[model samples]
Target: MNVGLGLPVDDPAALLTWAKRADAGPFSTLGLLDRLVYDNPEPLVTLAALAGATSRIRLQTEVLIAPVHRTALLAKQTATLDRLSGGRFTLGIGVGGRADDFLATGLDVHTRGRRLDEQMSQLRRVWAGDAYGEGAGPIGPAPSRPGGPEVLFGGFAPAAIRRVARWGDGFLGAALPPRFMDRLFRDVEASWKEAGRPGRPRLVAQTNVVLGPDAVVEDARRNLARYYAFTGNAAHFVDGLLTTPGRIREAVTGFTEIGADEVMLYCWAGDPGQIDRLAAALHG
Candidate 1:
């Protein structure tokens, strides 16, 4: 299975260094998370910068908040970056769960799911040169690829999964419990077949990781609390994926065994040395 690393550096210089080093590492892609107002920079903006700095690593938005972005503008931005990076961008998008984010955007959080559906449809239209309106032909400049970056949909609901089969080129996010994963993957395949699509969509799942023989469960517990607070899936949110170095390796192989095309590791290692050590363990 293809393996990737989530880059979540708080410092810009350190982020750049890690992005560059990650490209040099064995990872297949560099996944970045998106939040409009946060410690980290906007994902697409950060990705544009990384595109200029790295040559080969495929860049991705692990989950871009669809409600906050202007659909057409985001399409253009992604296209420009994909062209800049020579067709190395994957747009993984979701209807975000953060109510505070919607409140900050002056939008009703309750409508985010519908907004995500609409925005995704609009993005496809803009990318395909469909008229933006009666007078506007389309947004430009066109991406180097015939279509813009491939869009992957992520979420853990039936509605979200249907959208993945309907609109997205791929499905993303982790699967919980081996049985649930089997069912979800099977359902997605059936959905694709039902759509009369030719083949199964790309599948990627992320496993949270913090590597060290000395790593404490408290570090994971603390991080899990923060994650659960953000995503609100407290039951499965924090507890399922967080693991020690040895457990992480086993889980990665387990995900691979379940037929995931790629497995993204959410590296929570606190420093550069830790990141290097973790990468070495996975890469080696």
Candidate 2:
């Protein structure tokens, strides 16, 4: 399976430096996460900057919350990024779990799932150059790839899986345990088949890592705690951080064994050197 790196969105200097290093490294993809009312940089805008900075690495949003944005605008931005990146962008989208994010966007949190469903359909139509109304012409700078970037849907719910089968090209699994992934992989396969989709859905798994000395590990733990504090159990994520090469390798192997086509290692701390350390560990 191919390995990818998740860009740290909290620090601007570190994020840009890491993006450059990742583009030059052996990593197959560089990914970002999305959140409103957070310190992290906006995913799409960050990606556009990285697109200008790098040439080879595939760019992705680990999972962009689709329900909060206007469908046409999202489609336009995604298509623009895909074209700007020379067709190296893959869009992973979901109905985000944070109620505050929805509230901040002034969107109804309860209608997220339905909103994402409708948005995905509209996204396809927008990317296809279909006129929105009688007079409007197609959106410009069409996606470099046919039908826009590959859309990967992320969520563990039955409705989410159904949406994946219907509209998504892949499944994006984030920070899920192996047992859960086993079940999820099976469900994705079953759903795809039941939907009469022609081929198996691409499966991608993501998790955070913190590999270095004790100081680095502790820093990562603290950062993770702050990042996931909204979840009410930051320690749960902190405890799961990969602090050793052995642990990172084990996680990668385990995910690959369960049929993940790509595994993205997200760095918890904003240390730019973490990229080289991770690259060495993966290669070593």
Candidate 3:
């Protein structure tokens, strides 16, 4: 299995520094998280900068909340990003569970899941050079990839799992245990066959991490606590943090053993040096 690094979205300076460094070698992809009502930089805009900064590393939104954004605009933005990035873009999408995000964006929280299903189909038709609805004609700056950037669905809900077969190229698993991820991967494959998709869906697993001295590791724990505080179970996420080379290796191996095509380590420490620590840990 290949390994990927998740960029720390909270720090602007560290973003490019880490992206350029990771591009030199080590990680196969650079992932980012998204939240509309947060202090973190927007994933698409930040990744556009990374595209110019690095030539090789793949850039992806680990799970962009697709329902909040308008379909036509998203289609244009994603296609442009994919073209500018030389086809090194992957759109990992989900109908987020956070209500504040939807409420803040004037979306009906209850309708997002169904909306995302419609949006996914609309995105494909737009990317295929079909005249957009209302005779807007084909949106220019077509995606570098044939249909669009590869789409990977995230979430454990049945509808979300079914989306991988209906519209996505794969499943993007969240920070969950290997046993859970193994079952999710199997679920995605079974759903794919049930939907009559030609081949197995790509499976990618993600885990939060930071490998360094006690200070950096603690910084990560604190970050996770603040970010996931809304869950009221932030302690659970903090307790699962991967902080040592041995722990990182175990996490990677655990996911790989479960048939993950890629394991995405989300570094919360916000330190550029974490990339080196990750490379060493992966090699070790």
- Return model 2's CA RMSD, one decimal: 1.2
Alpha-carbon lDDT, every model: 0.76, 0.87, 0.91
| Model 3 C-alpha lDDT per residue in residues 15-80, reported as the tens digit of each score | 889999999977999999889888888889999999999999999998999999989999999999
What lDDT does candidate 3 reach at residue 110? 98
Which candidate, 1 or 2, would have the higher TM-score against the true structure? 2
Q: How far is candidate 3 from the true structure (C-alpha RMSD, Å)?
A: 0.9
Candidate of highest lDDT: 3
Ordering by lDDT: 3, 2, 1
lDDT of 1: 0.76
**Candidate 1 per-residue C-alpha lDDT over 1-284 given as tens digits, one digit per residue, 9 for 90 to 100:** 68888875455567788778888877888888887656656889899999999999899998999888887788889989889999999999898877777778899989888988888777778877787777778898788777668888888888888888888888886536444676777677778788888877888887676655445345554555565566566557556755556666776777777777888877644445556766667655
Q: Model 3 off-target regions past 4 Å?
A: none
Model 2 TM-score, 2 decimals? 0.97
In order of listing, the candidates' clash counts read 0, 0, 0
Candidate 1 regions exceeding 4 Å error are 175-179, 213-224, 231-238, 241-243
Judge candidate 3 against the unseen true structure and give its global Cα lDDT, from 0 to 1.
0.91
Predict model 2's lDDT versus the native.
0.87
Model 2 lDDT per residue over 1-284, tens place: 79999876658667778888989988999989888878888899999999999999999997899888887788889999999999999998999999999988899999999898888777888788887546776775689988879999988899988988999998988878666798998999999999999979999999889877788778788878988998899888888888888888888999999999999998877778888899888877
TM-score of each: 0.90, 0.97, 0.98
